[model samples]
Target: MLAPPLAAGELERPLVGQSEAVILSLCTRGNRLPHLMCCISIDEIDSLAPRRDEDSSEGKVAKISVLLSVLEGIKDVPNLMFFSATNRLHMMDEAFLRRMSGKFFVGRPSSEARKRILDKARNALNPKILKKLVVATTNFSGAALR
Candidate 1:
C-alpha cells in the first residue's frame, strides 16, 4: 500500500513524455540494481494523468497512452510496486485508477496526534506555546505540522 517517495523535481508539471520513462525505469530496475526490487510513490498523481475529455490536447492524450502502456508492460513484474497520492482523485483518469490495486484515504490528524507532532519541537517551544500550537493546528495534516 506504500512505496518510497520520489525526488521533488521528478514529478514536476508537463509530465507528458518524461513520466513514461521514469515509470519504466523504476519498474524494470530490479534486474540491474542490487536489491532486485524497486518501488515508487508518485505524489499529486492527478497532474500526471488527468482524465481525457473533449478538450484534451494531443500531447495530453499521447502522454496518457504512453503511461498506460508503461503500466501495462509492468503488470507481470514481480519485484516492482508503485503507489500514489492525490487530493483530487476525481480529476484522475479512469484508466489510471483502474490500474491501482487498492486505495486508501488518510484524514487529518486528531487532537492527540497533533499534540504529539508539536511535542517534537518541545525543546524549542515552552509548554504554554506547545499547548497553543496544538489548538492552533487543529485539522492540520501530519505533513503540515512537520
Candidate 2:
C-alpha cells in the first residue's frame, strides 16, 4: 500500500519500497522459521557511516556499534543472510565488512553498456526530440535520468 505524502507539520515517515514488501511477505509465509535476514544496501551504509570530514564529525565506530546492538536484539537466529554493497568498499570498517561475509564491487558501466543504456533511454522518450535530449545528458546516472 502506498502511503500519502507527509503534511507541512508532520514528521516524515520512512518510505517502504518493494523490497520491504517482499521481506514482509516472506516473514508472513514462514512464521515458524528461526532465521534473521538483513539486506543493507551500500547507499544506506554510507549514510550510516559517513566520512568524518568538515561536514560531519561522527566516527564509523559509533555507527557500527549501533548496528551491532540492533542485530544483537534479534532472537535466536541460526541462518543469517546479510548483504551490503559499496563503491568505496575500502572505506568501510574491517569489522563491519567481515559481518557482511561477501562483498561485491559495482563499477560504472563500460562504453558498450553506456551506449546500450543511452539507446534504451532514447527509445523510452516520447517524440523524436527525446533522442536529442538523451544525447545531451551524456554520462548521467540512472537516478539523474529520472
Maximum-TM-score candidate? 1
Stretches of candidate 2 off by over 4 Å are 1-32, 35-42, 50-62, 69-76, 124-146
* Per-residue C-alpha lDDT of model 2 across residues 16-88, encoded as one tens digit per residue: 2433333333223323454544332234454444344455433334444444433333431334343444556
What is candidate 1's TM-score against the reference?
A: 0.73
In each prediction, how many residue pairs overlap at the backbone (N, C-alpha, C within less than 3 A)?
Answer: 0, 0
Query: Residue 8 deviation, candidate 2, in Å?
Result: 24
Candidate lDDT scores, in order, read 0.73, 0.44
- Provide C-alpha RMSD values for all models, in order: 4.0, 8.8
